[model samples]
Target: MIGALLIILFSTKDVWAPDNINGLILLYNGDIETGSIVRVEEYNLLAYAIQTTLTQTVLEI
Candidate 1:
């Protein structure tokens, strides 16, 4: 059950250059990732994060 959730989570689409507000994402594994959440669509949520090291991470909400 957990594995399936992970697969679904990682499989969701990523948002880029979003025009929205910042929010926090609480994962099922007790990990938290923050980013600007554009919005939630159909079965997926979209967000993007830029790190201090000049790296970017895009994830589903």
Candidate 2:
């Protein structure tokens, strides 16, 4: 999960430079089925929260 997220993030930032992290996430979630769905959703929400918090923190700094 974290690996996928890192891939996605790096891909977004043009850092690690994957062609399609979104596709990878879809394949991963599909392969794992219900558990993956739940976990991905939860992780996404957590990631969003963390990102928001970090952004806010950086702004305050």
Candidate 3:
């Protein structure tokens, strides 16, 4: 199925920070509260946003 294929491409990393956490803390935060960020090599600054459980449900089109 397409679902299984998508999981294969994710960059799996164990994250631990105050702003948020994932993988291990999947329950209380609603099934899954995953996040990803990018850093522009020219600026050397990072930015990210949480793909919250609610937003995902509405945008699953």
Candidates in order have lDDT scores of 0.43, 0.39, 0.43
Error of 1 at 51 (Å): 26
Score candidate 3 by lDDT. 0.43
Error of 1 at 54 (Å): 22
Cα lDDT for residue 53, candidate 1: 21
Candidate 1 vs. true structure, TM-score: 0.25
- Candidate with top TM-score is 1
Query: Tens-digit lDDT track for model 1 on 1-61?
Result: 9999877766753542121112222233324345544555775665554321213345553
In angstroms, the error of model 3 at 11 is: 41
Q: Clashes in model 2: which pairs?
A: none
Off by over 4 Å in 3: 1-34, 50-61
Model 2, residue 2: C-alpha shift (Å)? 0.2
Ranking 1 against 3 by TM-score, winner: 1
Best-to-worst ranking by TM-score: 1, 2, 3
